[model samples]
Target: RTVTSKMDLLAFHTNTPNESLISSENGVDLSLGSQPLENTKVHFEEKQFVCSECGKGFTHKSALLTHKRIHTGEKPFACADCGKCFTQKSKASVLKHERIHTGEKPFVCLECGKRFTQKSSLHKHERVHTGEKPFACSDCGKCFTKKAYLVVHERIHRGEKPFECFECGKYFTTKSYLLTHERIHRGERPFTCSECGRCFTEKSSLLTHEHCGSAIGCRSCTTGILTLLESCAKDMRPIGFSLSHITYCC
Candidate 1:
């Protein structure tokens, strides 16, 4: 039964059971009919509700209303812990951001007992033990456990260094390396040796110093040992300096 006219719509609605006409706040009586009302003349065009800013349209008025918030820069969702505002009104996003302040990691790996705030993060961490590299590079046959790592690795093949140092105009593959390089320009040695109180620009340098300090007894002895080893292994010489080297030197 196709409703071709307003009379057919009214006849169809009147025959329906437990249906009633509803009124809008503007006092427009919107009837349960297929055609447009005589008084209200409300018609739903295809993609009728359009945004004023970006000209994006939605079929539903409610969807258009929600889409308008993007142009308005409206973020109704706020974190109770840190008062941080997020554009999304979802409770899941709020809970995930709240985990930073709460330090609550509910998702745990059974293999290593390593916990993560999100289940996806725990799944990625589990791949380390499983040796599962799901994300593969198209340029090369190298694979990574996470998609983000694969994206970063692909930049190497493309020779794309998006992160650049402002002072030296030098580029780096990762943002963290760029930040670490910037610390050098600022003379910031963040990593400090607990044994000798000597600061280094990178953590790996501090770690190597700690290992040398542990093997040689003191800071002065460690420096001497490093110098002697470098002198012996100079000009790219292959020297098997292991724990036995420390024993022999001591």
Candidate 2:
């Protein structure tokens, strides 16, 4: 996740074999293995064949699509619960869709056994466990694990705030996010923690606390203190266990 000066998306326009090799557009070279190009039939649209695997049938096209998902696991959607992480938007969406039917949470965190239907939820949960934040913002040093979190973060950097709450004169980058935050002032509790019967104004805070505990304490340099707390809480546990865990997990 290296940040670049360019804000435009990586785009591709179909070109013939001659142009793909000769033209200046050096985008992704999406060639299908060592297979011959003349073998598969192409379906033309607007300019070029928009669908490369058009006549290749369901299995053939699906396999290509599945392969593409590997290159770009563009899971644009995310779960509102448990802060689980995912690569595919559809997968997160499908799980959320199933929530209406089963009302069950399958994905669980390793540090704490919080359950969620989406893997993204579990990922956001694991951040609480290890406190591992690898995603760093280019504008600010503040770190986050998810892209959506980063998008909101970039608002501070770009100073292009489009998300504003008419009710409070507060501004944000995204409207949906601003509306969700506005609910906090409206006395709306959307996320309820199953661990301690505590409710949160937002899902993000709830996910954060499940691992870090309430806001009364400090999270910075707290990993060093956990061993002392463990020793104070349970003398039976060895002193080095916490240190060793943090050393390896960090």
Candidate 3:
């Protein structure tokens, strides 16, 4: 159940003809005989089609053309349902993305009965019940249930902040953090409270405001600590506690 590395994937393919390669069905290898040669010169010389932007060699010109879209930021495959575009023109990706709009769960787990839009997600979720952490950090012995989680954790040891804030000089280990930081620079508050016409940088802030503002009817107290104090004031007022005394304690 271990995740495949880039080298493992590359090694699976050989330039030599009929090398007796291992085959897999549902991630289970049928045969494990005859180990493939590693770090062979044929791998570099044999790949005819090469990418201009990244210099990644591809076996076919069509693969290289499909890969060029990664550098160009092109997503030609547009979903008719939601207008979302995808770089990979695969039917699986189109089907998976459409599930977001359709609220469909095609892949289901037999263990917990939890459903997922994609097969990969269901595969990852099955690891939770099995307690199988296939991805492990090389620097530290910390393991992750998902390969992406392990990759993100390795950045901490490598001191690699791949995501950079273009607005400011700040850098982040993850893209989501960089995106959240960019909102601050752009003064973009996407999360809004429908009850009150107030906006927040994060959705959790809006939820907290809504919880407290509903009881106190004070949407002006946007701060979480202030909302917490107001919530406590409402509860304590019933037990013979003065607002002045509560304010002094705060």
Candidate 4:
């Protein structure tokens, strides 16, 4: 028999103790002395707690409260060594930050036995041994070991120079180049040759000077003459100059 309501089902069960009643709405069997059919439906926990700022829903109130800290800009976890603040999402982040002060390198490479502070760094270092270049440029199809290197390489194809030198108003593709160029303005020759005690702003320049030897007097003067000869050769302008015929006088 079809049962419309809970009361009707109870009344029908009281009248006929042996017969089973089917729900009129959902066609669920309602037998006498049996549990209600409505209670047997699959239950799912609803996300009642929601973030007011971001509209993100969470099943537990505690999780919703923890997520709200992100929108509120609240960092309850602080590093003891450096006093740097981090979110309450994970305490693992705090442990990793503590490694910086403690100088702990837990991640180690199997190939070279080189240790790294973070697992990601260890993974990147492992690529060196494996010769894996996972990150590839879309334009040139050139592969790089790291994503940052690929990003810098893509800038070359686009002719993008984001880093700028304040002193000379010159732009560079990378911050390292801009910093090196600033040394010229500051007259900061950091790279020094041990042989002649001569300083150069770039290490490459110092290496070139070292290769020329102290007997050549000034390497710049010799390089200038060689460069002039090269230019003269390229222009087909015969100056009747030969490197073998020239005297070694600075």
Clashing pairs in 4: none
Regions of model 2 farther than 4 Å from truth = 1-48, 51-96, 166-170, 174-177, 180-250
- Highest lDDT model number: 4
Candidate 4 per-residue lDDT, tens place, 1-250, comes to: 8866657766876888789767676676667546544453312235789888988988799999888888888998877777788877476787778889899999999999999889999999999999999999999799999999998999999999999888778899999888899999999999988976878899977766666553342223554444433433333422333342232434
Which of 1 and 4 is ahead in TM-score? 1
| lDDT, residue 202, model 4 | 90
In terms of lDDT, the poorest run of 10 residues in model 4 is: 237-246
Q: Considering TM-score, which of the candidate structures 2 and 4 is the better prediction for this target?
A: 4
Give the residue spans of candidate 4 off by over 4 A. 1-80, 83-89, 203-250
Candidate 3 global CA lDDT score = 0.69
**Residue 119 of candidate 1: its Cα lDDT?**
91
lDDT string for model 1 (107-160, tens) is 999998988999989988999999999999998889999998998999999999
TM-score of 2: 0.38
Separately for all candidates shown, the number of backbone clashes (residues 3 or more apart, or on different chains) is 0, 11, 0, 0
Question: CA RMSD for every model?
Answer: 9.3, 16.4, 11.4, 10.7
Clashes in predicted model 3: 0
lDDT per model, in order? 0.70, 0.54, 0.69, 0.73
